[model samples]
Target: MTATTAAPAWRPAAPVPCAAPLPAVDRLRVAPRADGWTVTARVAVDPRDPNLAGHFPGQPIYPGVFVVETLCQAMAQAVPGTPRLRAVTSIRFLAALLGGDEMELTLDVDPAAPAAGAASPTEPGWTVRGTGRRHDGTVTAQLRAVFDAGAGA
Candidate 1:
């Protein structure tokens, strides 16, 4: 006879204090699709954003980390329940996301995947893909992220 073991359940870690709140997305909009959901948001980099301070003295450009953060935030909002980011499969920065550049972010979340709060080790979670583009249709960035249900009381 062969023995089998079930995968261990996943749980959220202890909460850690944060120094400050993460940046916000403006003019955010979420719409449901037949296969998934789409989120559209306007991101206008703030000149006062501390991240831009040392990015470059003379020619400061928007940091790629912030751009990815924006996409993660948008996905969390579009999807139901509290979703914790697990991994970023891929991300690409095509052009500089400069300050004051009102870029439009569009994210697509697969509806066929398990819901955030209902995900399990066997079921895994959901996948989200998106792109940030300027008004002129210039692609600023592209990314794919995986999320799982968050632990909550």
Candidate 2:
């Protein structure tokens, strides 16, 4: 089943730390590559999104946690099956994404990798590295996450 068809069954088993409702992915694009896949998503910042409130009160910059959630959601929609988030290996906020500032997330996923240092060498896993940037070219965030190998099954 492709991601689109499996959407209803996919849910995050891990507790997402996002303080507000997950951002809606306005657009999703996926391309199969020799190594794995390339996934991109567009997120529109809603000025009234609850995430903006209290995040700063006066200066609402989109929370970094929400950015991570957006990335995870995008990956789930880009591939089949729900990706059980195993670990967020890395996350960095180079710039702030403020209310009404749209951003695009791009991910390069390696789906056939074994879990790094897994107890069993055959344990399946995926490594995703990606970035979020504004339309004007301001790179706002960069992140990496690991997921169980059972996805796309």
Candidate 3:
């Protein structure tokens, strides 16, 4: 599909329907919403997970960056169109998420409103957020993001 022109505000990419179904390899469960996407996932720190080494030596906590990426994937699955993370404005690692923690990523896209710089309801621009809630019911981290422009951006 052709990419749409980006507006002054963050316009979400054209919404891509999530009818294709989730991939079996994905341990993440995606719940889509008009506002933003939510994801529940687990990390084993296996070699399969990207950038496992960057986490730490011996003690492997899931990388906070990965948490945001996972949330991005979840939001993409949920959001209609080509909503992509333009940038992570702010990310805070409030807690260390262990490999065993079942992470809950709740992204609040439209809620931030003016600050989020999201597009109008009628606009193609979409907002994205990242929240990491561990299986232990503790918050691991939170991410706020904005996206616009580019072919695969």
Report the Cα RMSD per candidate.
Answer: 12.3, 6.7, 10.8
Per-residue lDDT of 46 in model 2: 74
TM-score (C-alpha, index-matched) for candidate 3: 0.58
| Local accuracy of candidate 2 as per-residue lDDT tens digits, 1-153 | 134433322232333334427645767777775577777778877767766777878777778888877877776667666676777888999998888898888888886455465334366767888889998999999988877655456
lDDT of 1 by residue, 1-153 (tens): 111533223222212222213454665666665566666767677766776767766556778887776766665555666566777778999998776777787777774354443334345556778888987899998988777644351
Error of 1 at 130 (Å): 0.7
TM for every model, in the order presented, reads: 0.73, 0.77, 0.58
Ranking by lDDT: 2, 1, 3
Query: Which wins on TM-score, candidate 1 or candidate 2?
Result: 2
User: Could you tell me which residue pairs clash in candidate 2?
Assistant: none
Name the lDDT value of residue 54 in candidate 2. Answer: 75
Candidate 1 off by > 4 Å: 1-22, 112-121, 151-153
Error of 2 at 50 (Å): 1.7
Off by over 4 Å in 2: 1-20, 115-121, 150-153
Model 1 whole-model lDDT (C-alpha atoms): 0.65
lDDT of each: 0.65, 0.72, 0.53
Give the Å shift of residue 26 in candidate 2: 1.8
